[model samples]
Each structure stands twice: as structure tokens, then as C-alpha cells.
Target: MSVTESKAKTSVKTSKKNVKPAEAAALKEALEAAQIELVPLSALIKSPLNVRTIPYPVESVRELAESIETIGLIQNLVVHTLPEGMSGVAAGGRRLAALQLLLTENRIDAGYQVIVKRVSDELAVVASMVENNQRVAMHPAEQIAGFRKLSEQGKSPAQIGDQLGYGSRHVQRMLKLAHLAPEILELLANNTLDVEQCQALSLESDQARQVQVYEQVKAAYSTVSAHLIKRVITETEISVTHPRFVFIGRETYEAAGGVVREDLFSQEENDGTADRVLVDRLVMEKLETAALAIELNEDWSWSIGRENPLQNYGEDRENYLLLPVPEPQYTPDEQQRLDELYATQAATETYEDEAAIQVLIDEIESQAAHRQWTDEQKASCGVVACLHNGELCILRGIQKKVKTPGEADAATQATSRDLHVIDRKEPDAAEGISLPLLKKCLPNAHWLFRLPWYNSHRKQWP
Candidate 1:
């Protein structure tokens, strides 16, 4: 029987927070709520009056399905039942979707029992709106605290995760957040610090160090992201994946008493199944020391190992721009090798085979090794190390300016140079010019030629 025609009727228990004052009062007198019923999966239908408008993320829906599979549905679906074999979901659309996913996966049968609360059409929209919009989401800090409490009650991360329907790793990460300084947690609650920043902060186990790093960034900038926080905290460290480290060789670096810091969480690049070293400050220094030897051989009067902001801008900005580095020229043999590498790469690309692709990769590496800087270019240029796209980029042979007589002021020269660099023919004038107008500029071009427009419109003897 339809919910409207059923003999059973119960008054809805409404909370002030879940329902509006008018909705609560109106529902109290005008509508009758029904008790929960176990209906077949095929009998229920999604409500057109459902209040959820935003599409849920696919990942979230998938996780919900996992949760449902792990520990059956905890909540009942609300539906408005009609007499003509039509039923619409009034609330719990997400749960319904989860159930549907289970059915498609053959995890559940067509006649699988679904707990549903049948309501009348009159209260459908309001019931959906209340269920979706009224329930507030818990703050992240509170969630972390709850997880920590569960851990304190002698539950392992895996056990807690199983009960909560979350991954063990996620549960452990949440528990870690509960250890953050209360001040930092308060900032997170206030929405001043985001989840990423908190995660970065959690990297430092020492509470004092976290606060110190936080203050350092806060004092320097108005706002900070997780990347900025990590940059400040790991200022001395360098990724082992850095090209400079590979060039120096790990054995030579370790012989020089350099240490490599490995991340316990991340895996190896080759197999992606084994743990590997992540970063090293000592090894980075050893690599820099090796680079310094190269710097000495170049014989610059004076040079800094790193890029100096003062040297790149302000009083030195003009000098930096007025002088340009000479482009490296390759010898004939080098050019031939490069051409061979390009041909090999092209051949490998044409035949989509793995072995050919591997050979192409090796040839490209050889091509890079063959190219060398000219002696004169190296003599005049000094090397500077700078981070480019988060990797060490060694800039060789950057020239120093020699003052020239009768030169324009730096600002004016810079503006003129900027305009020259961006110079291009604008499309507006070129696109509008007609063939007749274009021909007018040519020698003896005026009456010798008639355009189609002129020839077609002119009066002719017939």
C-alpha cells in the first residue's frame, strides 16, 4: 500500500536546527510521517525534489561504496511513495547511489533489502532540503581529535579505519594531525591554515621548531602555502634526484662524508615497489664542492656559488641586461653526432618498439655530452647555480658588462629594448587591406589593373 493509504502514521520528530521554524510548525499539523520499511532495491526511485544540486566527486562516491560494502548502510533512504507504482527519493541520494553501485558490481542482488522511510508527496521537497542542508559538517580539527581519542582507547590504525570505513594510511595521517600545537590547531579551525600547510607543519616533530618555522614565514610574508613552508624547513636539503648529484656519483659523495636523507614514505623510481633515498644536504654540498673545482679552473676574478639577488637587480640590473652571453658554438664532429642522434630518434619514433625507444634515449644523452662551450666563451663567462623549476640549473658563461660611452639611461634603454623584443606585425591593419589598395603601392600599378569589383560594376557596351 502507498504511504498515504497505510494505516500506520507517526508524528515526525523535528529539530530546530534541521528544519526552519515555519517548516517545523507546518509539518507538525499538515503531514504524517511513516515508519521505516525494508523495500526491494528495484522498488525505490530517485526523487525529483531531492535538494542536492552539486555533483559529488567520483572518488567520494567510490569511497562511500567501499564503506557500504565494509559495514552495511548505517542510514535509511527517505522516499515519497505514490499509488501508481511510482516512488521518488526525498533524501539520502548518496546512499541510494552507493546501493546502486553495489547492485551493478553484483555484490548485491535485485531483491536486496533497502531500509527506506516512506513519506507523502506534500513533505518531499522540505524533507530532502532539511536532510541535506541542515546537517553541518564537522571541523577538520574536531575530526582529528576524534580519531586521536579512538587511538587512545586502544584501537590500532587498521582497526579504527575498518570501523570508520577509511584507509589505514588516512587514519594514521589524521592521528598525526592531533599532535599539532594547540595554537596551530586553532589557526586551522579558524581557516587561516589549510590542510596542506598543516601536513607540512606535521613534518616537524618538535613543537618548538614548528612554531619557529611558522613565525619565520608569517613575519616574511602575509600568506604561505605548503610549498613555501617546506622550502623554509628544508632549506639545507636537496633532492637526491638532482642532476648535479648524479654527475658527482654517490660513492664519491659518500667518501667525502656526505649523508643522504631517505624518505620512509616514498618508493623507488625504477621499480616503484621499493623504498629509496629522497634527499640529502651533505651530498648536495659535496656536489657543490665538485662544481667549485670547475669554477676555479674557469679562472673568474670573483664569483658567488649561488645567484645573488643584488647582482640580478637594483644597481646591477642595467649591467646584467646590457651584457648578453655568447651562444655556444658546436664543432663539425659534434654537429654530425647531433644529426645522427636526431635521425635515430626519428627512426625509433616511426617504429613503436620499446628497444628502439631505449636506443633513442641513449643517443639523445650522447648528443648532449658531445656539445661543449668555446674556450673564449668560458674564459669571459662565470658559472652561477640557481634553482629552475625546482631543480639545480648551472648557468655557465654569463657575461659582465663593460661600460660604453654615450649610452642612453638604463630605464629608457630597457623600455626601448622591451618594445623591440615584443615587436610583431599586428593583424588588424594587414587583415583589412584589400588587393586594390595593396597593388596601389607597387610600381606603375594604378590603372594597369582593374579589380573584380570595379570590372563587374562598370557600365559596358552590349
Candidate 2:
């Protein structure tokens, strides 16, 4: 047999908790001390004032009763027969249902009262549900539905309360759930939403409004429950006015003719470099500016930032914004043109043109040929930073300092210097005379003497 059937068979009562062996022994001892009788199902006549006039249904109770009537009632149910000889359950709904069914099926008399251990009404109810449904929990939604059905049938909350043995407040709370929309009801059943959502929903009058926001909430997170939604909905406004979230499918992105550059995410994952992010920053800035420019009215325009990884990621690296913008739209003809013009992604790079980069390579190689560099590119490797003409230039491995006697004397005068002076160590060939001295220079000639950037931070250089 399945566990349910086996449990039902072994259980002496419906809606009753199982006995702890020690507790059961204690109860047995108490029963003996109280002088209670263990009566068979065949004894104790039913009272005229039974509160539950309509008996609960039971199966196989008849067979059991017949077996008892013929073989004699075996395994008498425990009971604390009152001085008045009345019967009530301490722990047996199933046993009572079986016996009652037997009587109803004419296998036994209706007047029979099955024995049960006498205990507090509280203990009886708690135990009853535990014995039957610790595994099969009656959902809160179903309970509310049942209460609503009874209420609709003209049962007052108090009457329902008495019948269910609960306070009127609980009945009212359950009744409120019936007011929510059908979709919300389903969420409750599915346990996607909970009491909190319901409580918040109760405050709202508009069903459509509730539904619109509910869908947004459901879309935002996969695992939240209906009860939770109820709670969240009250305090958090998730609906149309500044809706809490936007689920923009890629269609939306491409719909605006966004020409995506290289997928930054893939590059970020691959290179893990500051340079890649710099490209992203520039792209986002261009995209935002472009978006603003295209819109006829600034009031109607919208833009979103590329998420700042540092703001969210770490303290070691200060937060930096990604300035990239959405790609400009492509007209069909322009797209065709771009598709033909560019051969590969290398063609999309912005910082360098092929001719310009080739020139820089030639410059560095030529400098390397004559400069005395320790390791060419690294520290103490006799390198000078310089901006030759206008292009960014890096001359590697220059051995000699290009100072004339006067320049050498000036260098001695400019002491007590910060990192800029130290960094300005890259020699500017325009300011000096030595081929190898040009080695170790910044390709961008402008950076040779002092960059405006470092100066803003209060650092100065010669």
C-alpha cells in the first residue's frame, strides 16, 4: 500500500497527531489513574444533541463494524467515559469515519458511538490534522475558497467560525482572499504569491491595475510567492507609472537601428584589460550623445548608462563610468555600404588608423636600433617618454640622457619632484639631442613635458 493508505489504515482517528511512545505511556498511565474505560465501537449510544448532525463520510467502516459484531469488537478505542456516559474524540477521525460509515451503510446501527481517548479539544484538533495531513497540507487558498463558499451560502462569519472552530477574524482574513483577481488566485494556488501580496492587493480597487502590476512583479523575479507579492505590492509601486522594471527584448534594441559594435562583454571576458573598458566608455558616451542629437525634443529622449563595474565591484579600483552609447541606426543602403566597406572587426577599431599605427611601429623600431635600453620597455631600462610632432610615440631602450651641459644643470636645479617629474623622465627628442635618448618616449608627443591630466591632480613635472 502507498504510505497514505497505510497511514490511514493504522491511524485510529482522523485529524489526530501520532502518539510519542513516552507520551502514549504517560497518557495510558493517566487513563488508569483517572479510572477511564476502553470501550469498543459497539458500545455508547449516540446523543440527540450531537453538534455534527450530518456525519462525515467514511469507507470500510461497515466491514470493520461487521467483523467486530461477528468476531466481537477487538482493539477497543481508548476513552475517558464521563460520568454521563457520553462519547467524543480525543484522537480519531478516520476510525470514527470508518465506524460511522459502517453504521450509515447499515453494517452497524447509527446509535453506536465509537470510543476515543478523552483529551482537550485543542489537542484533538491539532492531532487530527497531523495524523492525516502532515504531508497533504490543505492550501491557504483552498481554505479561503471554502470559507467564501460557505459565506455565500448565508453562513455568517461567526457561524463559520464556530463550525470550523476558529476565531471570526481568521474567517474574515480568508474571506478577503476571494476578492483578488483570478490570475492572483492562481498565483496563490501555485504559491507564487502569498499573504503579503494579498494584503496589499486588498487595498487596491482596480482589478486591471492589480493585474498589470502583478504581471510586472512576476516577470521581475522567478521565485517570489503570491503572499510575498501581496506584501511587496503595497509598499512598492511596480505598475505603469515609472514601472519598476523594463523587459526590453533584443527586438527593441535593434528596432531603433542600433548598430552594435563588438560585443564588449565577450571582449571583457577575454582580455580583462583596462583598455577594453576605455573603448566601452568612449562608445557609450558617443551613443548617449547621438541619441540626444537624433531626438527632435530632448524631453522625449531616454538613455541608460553602461553599468559601472567598479561602483558595484570593488574598492581597490575607484568607480568609473562606461561612456559608450547605443549604436547609431543604419539605413538599409548605409548598412549595405558598411557591410562592404569593412572586411573584419579590426577595421572597426577607432584609436588607430593602419597607416598611423604602421608609422608608430617604424618609429619605435628605428629608436630601438640606436637607443641604449636595459630591457627596452621596462623600468630603469633607459627609456624616455616623448611626444614627437603630434603623434603618440614610444621609443624603446634609449641608453643616454639627451641633456646638454645647460640642460643637465637645469635638471639638477629641478629637484624635490613628484611622480610627474619622475614620469617625465621619458625624454622628448625635440627638447634634446640623442637618437637612443628618443627611445622610451610617449608616442603622443604632447605627453612628453607635462600632461594636463596629471597636473589636475596637483602633480607637476619639469
Candidate 3:
């Protein structure tokens, strides 16, 4: 017989036959304690006031069922006696579903007994709420350890998945954590490393490398994402879609022995697939070299190529007292082009077709670029090229510092406009005006001031 059947046979009420008063009292007290009775599956019903009236997640219920089938019910269900000799389950609704599933699969019979505790209606309701509300979910680290133990104990991935209500892939993913270094695993246990980061680190074959990257990232950033960790470990450079890469051409970059990191899971669509990243910074610098060569060919006074334009520009300003500020001035032709661009933009408000809208956008951008910097402006002003909207943009006519030799008390002012001052004191009232005339003309004057001044000047008044 099953454990449930064995327990059920001894769970029924027993006769308190001929006994001493003390023995009777002891039996009575024993009844107050929760007793494990294996009640029949057919006798069990759901409580209307049960906290979990709705079905639990199917996967969770399935897992519970698998566990019960494998190891028997571990916890006793809190139940209350209902009318017509029936028992209603106030708690363990998921357990009931799991038993039902086992019965359906012929793993257990309808007469299978489930361990339960008989309680009062009020106690049953409270028990149900407490059971659900006070329950804590197991941490991922704990789950990993559990699954690893099961695996070591001869449980296959499929078997583990079946017993845990998880898919085979999920089981496999969990198992992968077993390969992590002990230190890294300890980090996960203490909440230092999150699940996603752990998963990303798992992609690397070397535990030492994983630990190294984890420590490096944890030191640098408050939180490290999977994508960032992947990029770091992969040593990939800027994306091919970057404007500088496009400007230099992928063929030229690859011919120079640059590595490309392609997304392993990306798919090709009608438009295109995900862009790959360039992995060698040295090869990337070839574009800078080429640019420098062209700039030198133009006979520039001085030219420098840098991977990061803003940092270079900032460094250039560090030694100087002040940065050059570019003042933008438009020639007559450029101003006309700007006006035409604005006119076309206004015309687009009436455009309805997609093609026409795209054409208008192209025209607007072209005009804007054309009028951006005139030849005269480029000749006299400096330029900066930096990343903008994942592309390269050239900013022209940045101002250089003005040389003021031997000037004292140099200060930077946001603006040179004169401050406007307002005088609050009004024109003094006529010195010899009559008191009655003054009161009549200044009807809004304070009564107290008028009365005191009038009384003091009574002898001088007309």
C-alpha cells in the first residue's frame, strides 16, 4: 500500500473507551493539536472562502504534481469538515490540483489518501491566508544548487524538467551555472551578480575569464548588463553601421585584418540583418590615418586624427586659458538657401504622399548641409567631428581663444548686455501745494500720514 493509504488507515477517529479522567483529558488536549489524517481524494472539496480561489499557474501546479508523485505529499493540507461528511480544502489548492493530475495520469487512484489537518472554519481561512502570504520564493542560486544536486544524483535534464515544471532548455540553462567558478557562484548567492549577468558570463567557456570580467565590471559600473558584458569579453569595437566605419568602407577595414563580431542569433529579413561590430581598434585607426593623410595633402597648417573628437577637443582646451568660441555668420547665398529650406519645410505641411515626404526631408537636409558652413567660414574657423545620433557630424566655426596680451583682471562673463535699472522713488509732491488741494488730488494717499502732516501745518495752511 502507498504511504497515503497507510497513513489514512490510522487517521480516523478512535474510541475513547473506558479510561481514567486524566487519560480522557489528555486525549481531549491531543485533539486540539493539528493531526495528520490521510483523507480520501474523493472526500476533499474546495473552500469558497479560500484565499486562492483561482487556479495556480499551470506550470507550478504541474511541478507540484510531479513532486507529489515522486515523493508523496510532504505538507498536510489545512481542511475543514463540511456538510454531508465532506472535507473542504481551505489551503493547498495547488496540492489538490497536483493530486488530481497524478490521478488522471493513473499514477494514483481516486481512493488515494492525502495528508491533511482538520481545522475550524475560522482557523481554516486564517491558515489559507498565512500559508500564501508568508511563503517566500527560493532564490535562483538555491534553485541552481538543487537542480545540480538532482543532476548529480542521476537525474537527466528531461527528468529534472519534468519534475520541476520547467522546459528542457531552462533545465539546461540552470545546469550551465554549475560550471561557474565558486567565487562567482558565491557572488550570485549574495546578490552581487544578477541572473542575466550570470547567464551572459556562462557563455564564456573559461571560469577564470568569467570571474575576471565580473570583477572588472562590478568595479566600474553599479550594474552590468548582459550585452555590455558580452561586448567586453568579446573585445568588439564600434558597430559597422558607425559613420566612420561606413566612411572607411567595410572591405578596406577587413582587408586590413580587422575582426567582425556577428550576432549569433540574428536572422536576415527582407530589409537586412543585424549589423556586426568591428573588433580591432588598431584596424579602426586606419580610417583615422587615411583621414590624416587627406588633411595633410590639403596642406593644412596642423592636423590631428583622434578616435574620440570631444576628448581631444577638451584636451586641446586644457592648456589654454579659454576655448575659442565660433561665431556663425551667413553669406547672402547661404542666407537665401536657408530661407528656401524653411520654405520647403513649410510646404511639407501640405504634403500627403510618403515619397513626397521623403523627398522633402532629403531636400531639407541637403539645403541645411549646403548652408551649414561657407568656404570663407571654413577657411577662418576650426571644425569638430563627433558622434551624433550614431553617425558622424561636422561642427564648423568653433571659436578659438582671443589673445589679449598683458590685460589684467580677465574674467569670463556670460553676456555683455547693460543692466536695466528702474527708479522706485516718485517725483516729490509740490512743496507749497495747499493741504485741501493735496488731499483732493491724492485721494489714494494714506489717511494717517495726511492727518498728522495736516495737524502739524495747521498754522501755515490757508
Candidate 4:
């Protein structure tokens, strides 16, 4: 017999020996009312009175089988006698199914014996209901402690999960909770901090820091949110979505000895945070290299790289002019394809399909033309490479030369005429001039000239 069965038999014998005369008679009567026997696995059938109507998951049954194989069944099935020597199980239906699974897998023989408590037919329903209703689930903290104990016993997460009918990742998550600071664990046990808050704390491996943050938040707010806890813990770190981190890329950043702390609860695969200084330096280096390449390939007079060009330049941004990008010219066949793509995009039923079609359209458009810079423009204009929305953006035709007052007035006149051409209905052409120019005849229209239709008509300008 297994250790479990031996202990069970020993306990029963001890209980019988300790019973008094009156109690012994009552025990005998109860034993006669419900007999315990070793019934054949094949002889047990699911009873009509079994409270659990929903079928057990296949994974649940498989895990149960693994548990039974490792440690013999600890509980006995409750069954009632039926005709022709068959017994209907009212309780422990999952256990019965698991045993059958083991038999089917050849882990156990077809004649394997299952321990069962045989009761009267009328008591079967009561037994099933009581068995299900009277049980209390283990608390999360207690579950975590149990998993930790199993881990301490040298069992791998996979093995522990198999015995407990949990996924290996779930077991690992619970084990992480086990490593939390004693104070944090106490908070979890006493319901002061929820599981999610503890999970947020787990992102920080330093128990001291976790406790510090917990105490700080507890004092600062009446109630703490999981997001707030995570933010406080990771305040100094750069999120994966940060422009610098995105520009450097996770692989390159890691290669440079940067560490990333991942959020296990996040649905996004790459959701994590990293050190800001390391990622910022990497971003600057990569941007500088990209700018150098662009300057050499395009024959620009000068090129400068900045993490954030607008922020770095500040008020000085007004000194330079942003040249508009030229429209792409496509052949008849390509244009037809583009039109068809747009039509299909408009009719697309799903966002995924529309995005895919847009990609194809972009590919065709990109092949049609490349940006061109006039020789005069190249001599006076430079390029600025900067990070925008986590992408490397190259701004060409950035005029660096300051304009003379006479030249500025002439340029303003030209802009006025162009604006007039656009809005022909306006009686006074001067009214078409942008507000910034009226305030001060600023030569650079980078800040004020932002009409959406201006790009398509840029080539028409003098």
C-alpha cells in the first residue's frame, strides 16, 4: 500500500480503538449504514445525483492523472450501490474520471482498484451537494506559500503545476510572490495589498525598494492603485515606448549591457522599462551615424542630429525654413493600381485588412519617386535628423542662411501671391497672408504656414 493509504488505515484503526462503548456502538451502526470498500475502476459510473454538471477540462483530467501517478489518491470516491454490481459515483466524479484516464493511458491496469465509500441510493444526492458546498478555496497568499514549499522541496515549477493542476507560468508567478519582502507578504496575507499590487511590486527585485515604495504610497494616498504602485517603483526607468528606447531597439540596448524589467501582467509582448541614460546615449549615437550617412549620400552642405530637434533648437527653430516634400509622380499603371487599392481600403470590413492594403499602397508610392534638392537649395540648406514618435525622421532642405530685409519682403510678397492663387475668391490678396507675417514679416514660415492643402500645390510656387 502507498504511504497515503497506510496513514489512512492507521488513522481509522486508532480512531476505533479510542471510541467508548456508546460511541463504538454508534460507529458500528454508521459503518453498517455506509460501507467502505475497494471497488474496480471499471465498476464506477457517474451518478445522476453528481452536482457538477459541467464537464471537467481535458487539462484538468490530465493533471489529475499525473497527480494520482505521483501520489496516490488521498480522498475516497462516494458511491451508491446499483444493480448488477455496478456503483454510481455521486462525489469525486473528477477523481473517478482521472483514474479512468490513467487506465486508458496504461499507467494503471484495467483491473486497478479505487477506494470508495458505498452509501444508500437516497444519500447520494446529499453527499454530492455537501461535498461541493462545504469546501472553501485556499487563499491566494496560502496558495503562494504552498507553491513556495513545493519549490523549496526541489521540485521544478512544471512538476509542482502538474501536481496542483496549474500552468507552469502560473506556478512561477505564485513563486515570485513567495520571494516578496516579509512585510509585503504580510500585507498580502492580511488583504492590505491585493494580488495585483504584489505583482507590481514583484517587478522590482529589490525587496527593500518595494517596501519603501509601499510605505510611501500608503502614507501619501487613502487607497493605492496598481498603476500608481508600478509608476512609483519604476519612476526613474524609461518605458519601452519611449522614443529613445524605441530608437535604440531592445536587442541593441541589451547588447550594450542595459537591463529591462518586464511587466508580466501586461498583454503586450515587449512591454518593459529600462534605464534612461543608457538608451539616450545609444539613440544619440545611432542618430549621428544616420545623419552622417544622409549628408554624404545626398551631398548636403551640413547635417546635424538631435534627440528632439524642436526641443533642442527651442526659439532658434524660427531661423530655419522647412522645405516641403515633393509629390510622387506615378505611371498610368501604378496610378490605376493606387486607385484600386484606395477603393479596396474604403470597402474593407476589418481594420487588419485596411492596414494591409495601405501597406501595399505605400510600397507602390515609395518606388515612384525620391526626394530631390536643387543645387542652390543644397548650397544654402542643410539637413536635420531627429527622433519623432520613436522613429528616425530626416528633415531635408533646412535653410540655415538668414535672409536680408529686402529679400524677406520679396519672399513675403511671393507668399502673398501664392496664397491669393489658392483662395481666388478673396478680393484683397494681402488678406490671404498668414497671421504671423502680418504680425512680423518673418522670412521663415515654418511655424505659421501649415495649411493641409499646401503640400500638393508646393511645386506650383516660384
Each model's TM-score, in the order given? Answer: 0.32, 0.27, 0.29, 0.53
lDDT of 4 by residue, 1-462 (tens): 000111122211100122234533643464467766898888988886564544567898899889999998888888888889888997788898899898888999867888888776544544554354334223456556556656766778776555444567667777887889989887766667777788789898899989998888888988776788998988889999776787788999999999999775566765889998888888888888887887888788888878664421334343555555445577899889977886776676775876577667656654453344567777776767777666776666676636687787575445433321121110112222234322344456565457644554444333
- Residue-wise C-alpha lDDT for candidate 3, range 122-165, written one tens digit per residue: 55544554355345333456556655756766778776555444
Better of 3 and 4 by lDDT: 4
lDDT of each: 0.55, 0.40, 0.54, 0.66
Can you give the lDDT of residue 371 in candidate 4?
41
Who is ahead in lDDT, 1 or 3?
A: 1
Best by TM-score: 4
Q: Considering lDDT, where higher is better, how would the candidates rank from best to worst?
A: 4, 1, 3, 2
Question: How many residue-pair clashes does candidate 1 contain?
Answer: 1
Which has the greatest lDDT?
A: 4
Candidate 4: segments with Cα more than 4 A from true spot: 1-136, 241-244, 267-270, 308-317, 324-371, 402-462
lDDT score for residue 461 of model 4:
35
Per-residue CA lDDT of candidate 2, range 361-396, in tens?
Answer: 333433433333222232322222222232222322
